[model samples]
Target: MTFDHYGIGHGFDRPGFGEAYFQAQGISAIHVMGRGDDWYQYADMDAAMATVRAATEGAVRVVTYGSSMGGYGALRFADAAGATDALALSPQYSLDPKVAAHERRWSQDFRRIRWRPDSNGPISCSARAVVVYDPIGPDRWHGERIAQDIACHLIRLPYTAHPVTTYLSDAGLLGPLIAGLLDGDFDPQAFRREARRNRSANGIYLGELAASQPRRRVATALSLARRALDVSPGNWHAQVSLARLLSQEGRHDEALSILAVLVQQSDRSLTYVVDLGNAFLHAGLTTEARAIADEVLSRAGDVAHLHAWAAHICWLNGDVADARRLIRRAVTLDAGNRVYLRAIIDYHFGAPYIAGVRGVRVTSWLRLARWMMKAPLRPEPAEAVRRPFPFRRRQDDSASDSAG
Candidate 1:
């Protein structure tokens, strides 16, 4: 049976599962009715559950599923009817007091009952329950607290809008509900395991966002990372993740501030140091970035990626020769690393450096050439070239080659 806000009870008609859900689960003999009404009203949910319970003769196994306002109704029904199980998707714990206060202007029906959490009808079910919500919802905190209190399994679907029922067909949504029903246990441990698994599956959705145009959606990623931090303030991964996103958005100062707090509370982590360097580099503070890279290298000298970042700092500081040398070292340490190889190639063949050489207009490039001639190139078995050579040939070499 399906229910709606109106008092119309209609035969349930979800093409995929309305009948199949009952038939496959051995619930075919039971009668299903859709109770369409405001279940929050005093006599509404009580009357409906009474009818269903009586019809099923106390042997009924009621599984209630609801979304949005309907979700609230389902919970009320579960509490009153002693349902076998319940599932509420994107439910509001209570109507916002601000909205309820404006009931007169919005709708006359809104004023028919109190909408505060305290005034809402109590849930009285002994049945196991599941509450699914989107963390970005306006009532997210209220929903989370309610789920926590009831010990209902909470499934946080990332990037979902206000009501998640629209995603009823989503595999990530249906697969778990089916699994939970079959398992017949909804204890805390089970909930935790399911939550973790769901989080792993949700990672695919994040990968899609990461692959979006403009390279990154810093705002969306940072918002989710912030939500994770709010849920678990001590989550080090969330904090670092937020910092990384902030750095991508060019909010380096904010990223640095977050990292500063995180590093103080924890040991010197490699991720923290690398992120700090990135933040500094994005903020146009090459010297500060180099200092961080130096500190990281002191402890992790052989880490090729760290050396590559340090080379970038050197390049930004107008030490092109040193930048090239450090980049070459980084590449030698990790030959298969495309990131370091790209940096090396950039230093060697990038348009700016090549243009400076062709135009003969950059004093820094001339100085770099002189320094390169004096410094010995580090020998590498993989290197095709053996030694550093001058950019211009000597007058004697030109005359001798001409004569020959």
Candidate 2:
């Protein structure tokens, strides 16, 4: 069986998820879709388990699979439905308020949800759990927490933050890893090899890595982005990173060139589209950026991140009224999504919610301190993952994302 993860809002373009991938491998799959409250509040999990059993009826065996929010559900369902094993990618330990008080990323979402069990019980499921996550990423706290009390084997890959599947899939590792686990032949070394094989070409990884470098090493950061483009010339976000860095260094022409080629490309990745719009605006290509933003907002998809991007573009175009409308729309679509909330905070608090303050160098000790305070954040390269403007001037009330 398979379950889908929690995106801030649905990616309407995505037709299928795990079930589709598994089906391609000749494995029959049952899918569990989480909508609205995302199972924590709306799903009658027990009834769904009964349905799975009734549907599978006398099957020789079963295993559960999911990533992120879906991963949490997979383990929760595996324990309830008596699945023999579970494959969870970046699973959270629990959403029970008391247990997850220290978890900051999705706090507001937890508060409004109809959290069922007060106490987060241990993973007492008979099934052996296989979890893959980045130890330094957002999933670390929960991943580590689950490993502490369960019959589980941990596969820690730090190259990708939060949803390792995004990075894993980029390396063509997810399908094989899941297949191997299902066949009871998972080879950790093989998995590691697969992850490393195309590391250089993983533009998202490279872009993230470059953004994490010290501010004083802007040249080094530019080189990392250059390396990223060398291996994957079509990485739009990497191009945007490169352009942003060049712009910071006062090389406007070169920056505009990188973004010009990027905006002309045919890549359809959401972040690519979003970052392209950012690059266009940064290059003083307002009409072009506004066109893309308008097109994104006009689409039927309700993805919060995309809406957030569109909102940013509107703000950039000085359409404050339209920006307000778009940001409000984003909040309505996914109030739990912090990016949207951050936009609201930026508007209300007059702070650089997206770009953050100038030169806020998060020291190593600060990272450790945050780790002790709550979950350890994938600090470096993370902020740069989305924020791309380290040298940006605080003009009027806006800042841009270069990394995380």
Q: Each model's TM-score, in the order given? A: 0.40, 0.70
* Cα lDDT of model 2 by residue, 57-114, tens digit: 7766678888888788778778666677798888888877677777765544565576
Query: What lDDT would each prediction earn against the true structure?
Result: 0.57, 0.68
Tally clashing residue pairs in candidate 2.
14
What is candidate 1's lDDT per residue for 269-362, written digit by digit as tens? 7767777887888889888887887788888665566677778778887778878777766755554444554455457643223323544335
Listed per candidate, the RMSD to the true structure in angstroms reads 23.2, 12.1
